[model samples]
Structure formats: structure tokens, C-alpha cells
Target: MAAAIGALTLRATRAGLYSRLTSGVQGVDATTYPVLSGLARVGPVTATKLAEAIGMDRTVATRYATRLQEAGLIDRRPDPADARATELVLTAEGERAVTALRGAMESFLAEEMATWPPGEAAAFAMRLEHLTESLVQGEAGRSC
Candidate 1:
């Protein structure tokens, strides 16, 4: 199971896959996609917090946040909770990029599963979701 998971992770994270996924989205590549997608999931957050959530280095997150900000895909605004620190928020363009990325990924997966048996893909998706939930829960338990 570990080997299979590792192989899948490698294949899914390859540069080619990222290029394909981000084809239509400008200013987004493998290095920056995680930050963009992470922001979409967690909403406005400090770069440090976003980095922690996405398993990226704080400096890397801050740097990419700046790049994304320059691209007009994200905005850095004063944090409501902390006056000294800023939170990263996705702009309208950023939201659109996320949507496009998701659509592309869905299309890619559909193509990959084209040869699968009628219900097999759906079954696999369910199992994958369950496995992800279980892994997340287990990680939480360990952290506590």
C-alpha cells in the first residue's frame, strides 16, 4: 500500500502533470500551485500559517505569495487578528485560476479512467476519499 501510494504521489506531482493542469492559468507552476490551492482551501491566512497547512517552508510561501500578489491573483491585506501581520486572500482572478485548475485535473482523470470498468473509477474514488479521511484522522491523533 505504501509503495503504491508513493508511486501515485510521484506521478501525480510530476512537472508534466503540473504543466498540463496549469496550462491555461498564467503565473502558476508546480512551486506556486500549492500556495494558490492552499489559499483556496483555507481562506485568508498569514504566509506562515499557509505554509504550515501546505507543508511548505515559511520563506518559500512568503516569496510565492509576493509573486502571486504581483500577478494580481492574490492580495495581501492587514490581518484582522493581528495588526502587524498580513493575510493572503485570493483575488477574483485567483478564484478563476483555481476553477480552471480543477476542471483540467478532472478532465485529465477522466481520460485516465476511460479504460476502466464502468463502476470501477467511482468505487476507487470512494475508497480513496475514505483512505484520505482515515490518514488525516490518524495524523491528527499523532499530533495530539
Candidate 2:
């Protein structure tokens, strides 16, 4: 399982995969994928918080947030709780880009699984999702 997960991670992290996923989606690339996808999952958050959430450097997060802002894919707004701090939120365009990315990923996975029996693919997907959820929950618990 560990080897399989590692292989999947390696494959998923390849620039070619990201390039394919972000194709036709302007201003998005492997560098900005974590920022955009992190925002999609966690909603509005400060760059520092986003960095923490995504396990990236704060400077990198801030830089990518700036790039995304310039591309008009994300917005930087004053945090409601703090007048001095700002939060990054996806624009409508960013949402569309994320949707496209997700669709592409799903299509890619479907294509990869095309050779497998449909039931086996479905079961694997279900188990994978469950495992992911459980791991996330365990991490959340450990963080507390």
C-alpha cells in the first residue's frame, strides 16, 4: 500500500500531469496548483495559513498568491477578523479553473482505470476515498 501510494503520488506530482490538467487554463501551472487547490478545499485564508495547510513555505504561498492575484484567478482581501491581515479567495475564474482541473483529473483517472472491471474500479475508488478521509481525520486529531 505504501509503495502504491508513493507511486501514485509521484505520478500525480509530475509536471506533465499538471501541464495536462492545466492545459487551456491560463495562468495556472504546477507551482500554483497547491495554492489554487488548497483554497478550493479550505476557502478564504491568509497566505501563511494556507502555507501551513498545504505544507508549503509561507513565502512560496505568498508569492503564488500574488501571481494568482495578478492572473485575476484569486483575490486578496482584508481578513474580517483582522484589519491588518489579508485572506486569499478564489475568483469566479479560479473556481472555473479548479472545476476544469478536477474534471481533467477525473478523466485521467477514468482512462487509467478503463482496463479494470468497473466494479473493481468503483470499489477501489471508494476505499481510497475512505482511506484519505481517515488519514485526514487522524492528522487533524494529532494537530489538536
Candidate 3:
């Protein structure tokens, strides 16, 4: 599933929309904002947990987090519950970036789907939401 998603993602931005939209940021790419948004969406969490939630390897998640940290987009603070662990959270800058990224994506989607019938787009979004919820539930079942 990840492989298929990865392959699709690689081609999804072939037009370089993400790059063009985020041209001012240094060392930030399409992956950077998504990872940052994932962190913000999940709130404060250990890198390992965040990785699992985002379907990324722990090492890769750490690398992304580290990059964002270096870029001042995120901050890592000591976990109050765990002495040896750290919690990742989005910095103010990160939050702004996530907000902008989400807005941009939504705007782009709206324009692209403007020609589609309203019900069809709504149905597609609903179907996607249901699928995502099912997957999350299935994972929770397995974890328990």
C-alpha cells in the first residue's frame, strides 16, 4: 500500500506545483510540509509514534523532524511523561506553513473540481473519509 502511494505521490507533483508554491522556503520540499502538517495534526508526540501515525519509518520521521527543527519550523521538547524521550510539536512558523499549505491545496482542488458535478465531488470526499476511518479503526483493532 505504501509503495503504491509513494509511486503515485512521485508522479502527483510532476508539474512542480508544490515546489512553485513553496519557492521561498529553503530546504523544504513537498515532503517537508506534509510531515509538518502531520505533526501538527497529531499534536505533541514521540517521533516513533508520529512515524507510525503517518505511516513512515521511525528513522525517516526523525530525519524529517530534524530537518524541520533545523529550519526553525518545529521544536522538540522533553516529554513530561518520559525522561528519556522528546515530544515533537510545530513551531509558530510551522503552524502558519501548515495553514497556508492546506489553504493552497484546498484552493487548487476547488478549481480543479469546479467542472465536476457537486454531488460527485462530495461523494468522492465522503468515500475517502470513510476509507481512512476504516483503516484507522483496523489498525487500532490490531494494536489492541
**TM-scores for all candidates?**
0.78, 0.76, 0.74
Q: Kindly list the per-residue Cα lDDT of model 3 for residues 25-133, writing each as its tens digit.
A: 6546866755787888889899999998888889999999999999988999999888989999888887787777777778888999999986899898897789778
lDDT of 2 by residue, 15-56 (tens): 777787777799898889989999999999899999999878
- Candidate 2: C-alpha lDDT: 0.89
Model 3 TM-score relative to the real fold: 0.74
Better of 1 and 2 by TM-score: 1
Residue 44 displacement in candidate 1 (angstroms): 1.6
Best TM-score among the predictions, by candidate number? 1
lDDT of 3: 0.80
The candidate with the higher TM-score, 1 or 3, is 1
- By summed lDDT, the worst window of 10 consecutive residues in model 3 runs over 6-15
Can you write out model 1's per-residue Cα lDDT over 1-144, one digit (the tens) per residue? 998887767866577777777778998988789999999999999999999998789999999999999989999999877898999999999999999998998888999999999999989999999998898789879987
